[model samples]
Every structure is written in C-alpha cells, then in structure tokens.
Target: RVLVAEPRRIAARAAARRMAWLLGERPGGKVGFTVRGERQAGRGTVVEVVTTGVLLQRLQRDQELAGVDVVVLDECHERHLDADTAAAFLLDVRATLRPDLRLIAASATTDAEGWARLLGDGGTDGGGVEDGRADGTGGGADGSGSERWDGRPGKPAPVVSAPGVSHPVEVVWAPPERPVRPPHGMRVDPALLDHVAAVVRRALREREGDVLCFLPGVGEIARVAGKLGGLDGAEVLQVHGRAPAAVQEAVLSGADGGRRRVVLATSVAESSLTVPGVRIVVDCGLAREPRMDHARGLSALTTVRASRAAARQRAGRAGREAPGVVYRCWPEAEDARLPRFPSPEIAGADLTAFALQTACWGDPDASGLALLDPPPAGAMTAARETLTAIGAVDTAGRATERGTRMARLGLHPRLARALIDGAKEVGARRAAEVVALLSEEPPREYGDDLAAAWRTARHGGDPYATRWRQEARRLEHALTPETSARRGTARGGDGPGRSENGPGRGGDDPEHSSGDPGRRGDGPGRGSDQRGGGGPSRGEDGPGHGGDPRGGGGPARRGDGPRGDNLPTRGSDLRGGNGPARRGDGPGRGGHDPARGGDGPRGG
Candidate 1:
C-alpha cells in the first residue's frame, strides 16, 4: 500500500529488514522489500521498500501504480539520475493522472525550500513565513524564529523539522602535521591514509566505544585496515560496495561484547543504516564522485574532498547511541571551502539509457517531463544516435518495438542490445552468459578478452564468477528463443517494417532518400552522370553531365558535344562568345564553349 524508495539496493534491503524488526515479526512481516534478483514482500505487507531503479521500472510499465497510495522517496538529497527521473514522472502523475497520490520526498540535509517549492504550489511562485521555532513554541515579537523573505512562508508545503536527539559529540581536528598531495583522479595520498590509521589507533586506545572510520573508497579502506593490524584483540572489518554480503551484514551487526571493533567503510556508511556502538568516528574527509570523459568514452570514479554536509552526516553516526567524538582529518578552517552539496548525477552521467526510457515513455525529448534539471542537449543527441544505431529508435526518434523490449529487460540499452543481438548470433545460453559477464564486469585478473573471461566465469571459483553464473541463468531464462520470438511477433506491428535498402526507412524523405552514392539508377538522378545537377544524361563524367554516357540515358542527344542543342553550355553566350556569358544570354553563367554558343545548339 505504501512504497519507500532507496537509492541503493543494500540500503533498501537494510531499511526493509529494520522495518520488519520494528514490526516484531519475520518471514511474513508487515514490511518487505523488492530489489533486482530478490523479493521479500508477501500479500499482507503494508510497506514495500524498493530501489529507485525498481520504482522507475514499475512506473514505466504502469503509470497509475495500481494500488499504491503513498510513495516515500527516501534519500532524495542524493540526487541520483533514476531518483530524479522517477520524481519527475511521479510529479507528472500527481499533477494529471493521480491527484490523490501522496508523494513524500525525505532526506537528512535536503534543500527544504527548493523541494517545498517543487512539490508545494505546483512549482510556481508562492510565499509564506513560519516561526523558526525548534520546539513548536511561539517566537518573540522580534521574530527570532526561522524567517523567510519578509516573514512570509516561501511556499504552500510547510517545513516540518524533528529535533534530533541531543548528544554531546566532541569535535577533534586531526589534520596531518606534514603536507600531503591532494586527492587526484581516484588516488588519495598515501600519507593521509597513514594519518587516518593513526587516528583509528588513537581512538581505539583512548575512546570508550567502537571506532567507525570513513574512507573515500574500498582501496583506501583496505589500506587503512592493513595499517591497523597492530591493534591487539580488536576486530577490524571493511565495508564497501564490493564487500561480500555476509561481511557487510557482519559489520552492521557490530562486534561481540568482549572484543573492541574498528569498522572501515566507504560513503555507504555515511547515512541510513547505523553501525551500533560506534562512539568514535575517524573522518578521512574524502569521497568519490562518478566522472566521465565523454570525449574518450571513459567513465570512472574520482576522489574529491567531502562536502561539509557529508561531514556532519558522518559525525552524526558516532552520536547515534551516546556522547561521541569525531576526529576530522582536515583542518577545521578548510571546511568552509567544501562544496555545499554533491552534483546531481544527471548533469554529468551518460544518458543513453535515460533517452531510451523517455522515448519508451512517449516523451522522446523529455521536454514535457518536470525534471529538476533537463538532460544536456548534446548528451541527449548522442544517446539518440546510439539508440538509432542499435535499432532501438527510428529516424523520427520514436521508440521501436525492440527498444521497448530492451527497456523492459532492466538493463542498460547498450547491454540490452548486446544480449538481444548476441542471442540471435549465438545461442540464448551463450549470449546470456556473455551478457552476464558484461553486466557485472569481470575481474581484471580475468583478462581483457571477453571470451577468456566467459570461460573463466564458467569454471572459476571466485565470488564474482559465482554471481555471474547466477545472473547468466536468470538472463538465459528471460531470453529464451521462444519468448524472444513471441515478443517480436506480438510487437511486430508496433515497429516500422524494414526497408529493402537499409534500416530506418519509415521517416525517409522521398525527395532526398539516404541511399548509397554508388547505387545509381534506383531513384531520381540515378541516370545523371553529373555531380550536382539532375536529369537523364549520357556524357563523360563531369559536373554538367545529366546522365550516363554508356547507357545513353542522359538528356543530351547521342554524339553531341558537352553542350548539345537542347542543353546549355556553361559560360557560352547565346550571342556567341568564348569567355564568361552575359546575364542577358540567360541566367547566371560560367565557363562554356563559344563554338556551340548562339543558335548552334541550345548552348548557354
């Protein structure tokens, strides 16, 4: 009945499990979750936790969302591309399709006014004011409470603030004594890692509770974990996206009462799920951002200084249970220069899949949708060209039947095309196996050759290989030949018929068909031997020839000079001249034979 969308699958599962715990039941609890490759909800479930990606997919299939009454977009401040797109479409539904639907966007450090304006007065200019009372108490006549422009409420949506539980968290600035090279690309200076490890050790010795250290990424976590090995009787754990599910679960479970613990984690631990008993926080003051070099077609993660808002969130983790301490790795004065918020993914991410989704949703340009930020024009054009190349869209930028199928596959458009086309090239099983490897890229040790990686994944004992096999089986079932054929036949009428000449002929212009330059005589100007002009002509290959000379299809008479009696020669004066023709002779003129001028032929 109620939907909660999280940015990541792990977070969704964690939220669902936590909600189920609160319900005091298992197996058939009132709260459940549905993510890719997993579903836990039952018929009696009241709250269904799902990833933003899953929510978007569901909306694409059923715009009305059937029985759903309330949709809570959790962690909206993250600003993921799918979340933003989902929010826009949800707003569309709220505006026109389902006015009764209750949409709630939740976040810890969100731009309250921006979101209130977006969802409040229907994204229009409306203002009001509220007292800046933290305890819902009245303010003094001086208006000491939160005041907007001239004490007027900014929008219709009221800003509700829940006072956080009070806990005295001591802030400790532990900047490195010596200068270290700043984070560049995905690399963090090793010196900073060394300092963070020292801080973790110091926290273990002096602090009372377990230590939770935040690093930029997995690599840094591993290095810091290694450096902290000297801590006797302490259990050190690493938590990252690539960490095994059991390990991540163990990290969240906290350490046994007898042992001291140190948990090294990436930004994944910044919010949402709590690490129990973490009273001392070691902040490395760095985070990774997704970067794309569109010119080189390379996408990678880049390290950057953490935002101040993120620092606050990290510090809050330590105070979840009791009074705590936060050791910031950077100088307190430097915090002012940090970015106020992380960049939205839509602004820089490759939008091929987004373009396909919009096209399938019948909004190809995505102009009609109410997105916070419209997809960049150049990126959208590139995405359309990619879709067109893969037969996902027609020349008119409409989604083809194949495109619809691809979108339903729940994969990137490129990977979907590979899976569909690969299945036809090879067997369904082989294609699925290959696509599964691509879906979760093979380990570098698996080698660069995909064929080798496929073989390794089939026979290797690595965890990645195990996951790949499971995914391959799922893909194989989804892409059976019969199913593919049935889908193709069912939607065959929806797609334009393929032309005999080439693909994308549905919207082709008859006057200027995009045919091969060599394939003459198939349409207008086919018989023309000339480069620019068009007519039936048989003459030497030149700019003025109108047709093929060998076939005599040209407009000129046989054995006639370049300027025949019927054809005018370039620059040949009708009054009989050798050089440039006069404008009085005809229209514009250039070099033409004077011998064939005047009344000799129709020269000039």
Candidate 2:
C-alpha cells in the first residue's frame, strides 16, 4: 500500500516533534536518545530526538546497519554538513547493507531532478534518464517497478511517487553589480560591511517581516550589530552560540505584535529550525571553519566563500511565506568558487571523541574505518598520542576504565584532565570553573599577560567569565580533605603530596632557573642578570658550533699595543697609512708574523 501524505500534513516541525516523542520511550538496549538536560534511554529498539547536529555526528561514528527502517531527511537543501552526511550515509547504507530501507529526502526547493537520478530513477517514470534509469522507466532489473508512480504514462512503475507539482520559476534579472573588495591581504572586506548595511536598511524600509543578516562569526555579527545600533520600531537582536538561552529566545521571538525584527546571527542559523517570519536575508557569503594543519599540530580558522547550495537555501528563507528579497554581499562571479558542500567537522575538529568512541567500539584502527572523508593520519596519530599522554588510552591504545568514565562527561580530554585535577585538589569548584571556560569563550578582556588575564577574569562581570568562576567556586566547595586539602597548597610543589588546588600553588615556573640569575634556564637558556665584573656571570648561550657576530653577541676586539718590543724605525707613522711611508726593506721592516703562531718574520 502506497501512502500519500500532504506536505503540510506532516511538516518538518511536526515530524521532528513526533520523532522526539517516540525516542523518549524506552525500547531495548540497542538505541538511545541523549540531549543536554537528560538522556532518555540507555539502549532501545528505536530512538528519535533533537540535538544540535549531534545525530548525524553520532551516525558517522557507526557506519554499519543501525536497524533504522526509514530516515526522513527534512530540509536537506539547507546544505548543512549534518543533513548532507545523513542523506549520503543513508543512501550508501541502502545501496549496500539495507536495500529494504527507505529514505524520504524532504526539501522545499531541493534539486529534484538530480536527486531522482541518485535514487535510481529512469526516464519512463516521469523522471529524466539521468535518474540512473533507462527510458525513464524501471528497466525490469532487480524486480521492483523502481520508477513509475503518480501515473506518468509508463509501465505502472511503483518505484517512486511525486508528492505534488509546481509551476516553473521565472527569473527577473537585475543589473549586474559587485560588492567592493578590501585591500589585498586583509580578510575583512569593508565593501561587505557597506553592502550588508545597505541591505539591512532597505529591508527595514520595505520589508514588513523580520530581517536576518547572516554573518561569518560572532565577532563580525557583534561589530555589525553595533554599527546598526537598535533600529527604530525594530528590535535589533544579535544571536550566537555562546549567548544565554533567554537572550536567544528574545531575539528569535522578535519584538511585540509582529514588529520589525533584525537578527544578526551566525552559521548556526543556517538549518535545523526556522525562526518565524523572516523574509529578508542579507548574506555576507562568508563562513568561518576550522581546518587542520597536521604539520603545525594545530587547527587554524579560515573564512571562505559559501557554496551555491548554501546561498540558495539562505535565499529560500525569503520565499518561505511570500516572495521576498535576498541580498548577496559578494559579486555573482564569486558564486562559482564556493564549495558544493561544507567540510565535515570530523575532518578538522579535535578528535578526542573519535579516539574514545572508536576504542569503545573495539576498533583500534579508527583511521581505517570507512569514513566518507577520512581524517588525516597525522591527526589520528596525534589524537592517539594525546589520549595516551592523558592516560585515557594505555600503551596498547585501549581506553582504560577511567577513560570510559571521563568520556561520560562529554568534554574534551584536556578539559577532562583539568576537571579531574581540579576536583582532586581544589574540590569541584576549580575544576568546573576551568571546564566551563574551556567549553565557552576564554577570558576575553584579559590581555597578552597571563597574570593580568587571570586577574581580569577574576574581576570581570561578564556572564561567561562569571559562570566559569562560579563553577570554580563550586568545585572548591566540593573538596574533601582526603582528596583535596591534603595536597600541597603552594606553587613549585610538584613533589609527593603536592596539591592541585588553587592557581599559583601547583609548581615552579618552568621559565625560571631556581631564582639564580646566573644559572641557565630551560631551552636556549636565559642570560644571567649579574653585577658588572662578576666573573663573566652572563655568558652567551649560543650554539655549541659558535655563532656569527651579526647575532646578539659582541664582536671580537684586539689590544692597542700588540708588539712587546719596540725599535726606532724610519718612515713609520702611528695615525694613518698616508703619514706612515714605511718600506718593506727599511729598518725594523723584518717584523714578527703574528699570523704564523705569533712568530715574527725572519730578519733579513
């Protein structure tokens, strides 16, 4: 029996809600749904839930059959990595292991023709021949109608069905234009700023609905929102991941009585859920992502152009209710350069979780797992090494019992270490403080000086910083003598019974050499601060192979009086060679050859 459900009958929101409810029920011990507040199940037969893009991530970890009957991929044309990966992974699984399973890829303005091809559609089923079929019909291959549905004049094909029909979209051409570019080498383009501001002002003037300006990151959003100042008769709201939930709700809800609203947001607004009544979209065409540089042992952030797919989805935000306008901050020519799909987080993110989960799953060679885009070998190796260094993974590359417990915390391994250390020394107070800070933005008001940074953080009233300090206090209050107070409570106390509690009470400053200015410190050793004429207290800590004078050291010098014996000589001058008309054959001409072992030349 084929089911025909109206698009509005079961919308994405309704479906998500339904799934969330279903997952809330406990099944067997095989499936589960976990959210921030609570985890509904440990193991179950079927699970469904809403998380901030963590579902697709979880699925990526388990590539085999997950016993799912159907995957309703809603809003896929959003071009989110999570949605794209879910669709691709489902297709792969259907083609490989679970051919009986079904995939309902839903999108308001998806590339239907292209997707039909991916679904093995043929020409005979009202789908184009490019749909991986012959004559638009199921070529009578592996026994199912495979293509014909909704009666499009073929062999009664039951392989596919068309939910509804749509009229062709007509394009209205505007004059060609380009956004001004920044000077070479600078990443932030001023032209982008002007373009964004212009679009926003236009939206406020003409559009009655809320305006959403998609910026690259929180920093750019903040800067632009500040420039906009609060718009008259409009609630100017800035939204980002780190903002408080109440602030997010206010921004997302907009002003009273359907008033004009402007939400300055990041890429987090790109998908998953829709903010009501947004009809004007201002796109900056830039997004920030972390890309790994394995050689550097760090992940660097880069801002790059958004994909055409992403741009289209953003534009679709305008047409959700009625036809609206989308302003692109970049020249149309740059659209071609955008990536077709966003990069996977797994490819570039810190892989502490990858290491932990793979260990739990009994896969030692996680790099060898059949990933769509595998992580770099160096990154995987680095993750393993980090795990071992933290004792999460043993010499054999297996997760210890402690590692398992730490994984339950859902924190990065390093943060977990800090938490454990903090708990053991200062009670739970300091550990929670450090954990919260590590999870959110670091202490922002602090300058380059570490001591000053700590001091400023201690006094700053920003919610993020305050929450961290509060957690630190909680950890401190949670301390037990057997676990914490018994430990040393002073700095430079790294030996037995050393306490981990309180900053500046842990160990010696590694950069100092035991308060001895003359003693060389670690690495390229510091110069000794000694009194003048203190028996060469500060020696040049240069390379053992000697060094060039062009460096920091002083040049070699010679004494004024080199010859011990003196004799009266004619045509000799002390000041300049011009006055010194000395001759080689004259008296005192047979001088010692200083270059030849200090021996004077033989007197002829």
Number of the predicted model whose TM-score against the real structure is largest: 1
Can you write out model 2's per-residue Cα lDDT over 331-380, one digit (the tens) per residue?
A: 65666786765555456644554566566545554532333345567667
Stretches off by above 4 angstroms in model 1 are 121-156, 164-166, 444-449, 480-604
Residues 89-203 of candidate 1 have per-residue lDDT tens digits of 8877877788777777776666555555555533222211122222333211221233222233433345555555637689999999999899765456778888999988888
Q: How well does model 2 score by local distance difference test? A: 0.40
Best by lDDT: 1
What is the lDDT, from 0 to 100, of the residue 445 in candidate 1?
Answer: 63
TM-score of each: 0.74, 0.56
Evaluated at residue 9, the lDDT of candidate 2 is: 9
RMSD (Å) of each candidate, 1 decimal:
20.0, 21.7
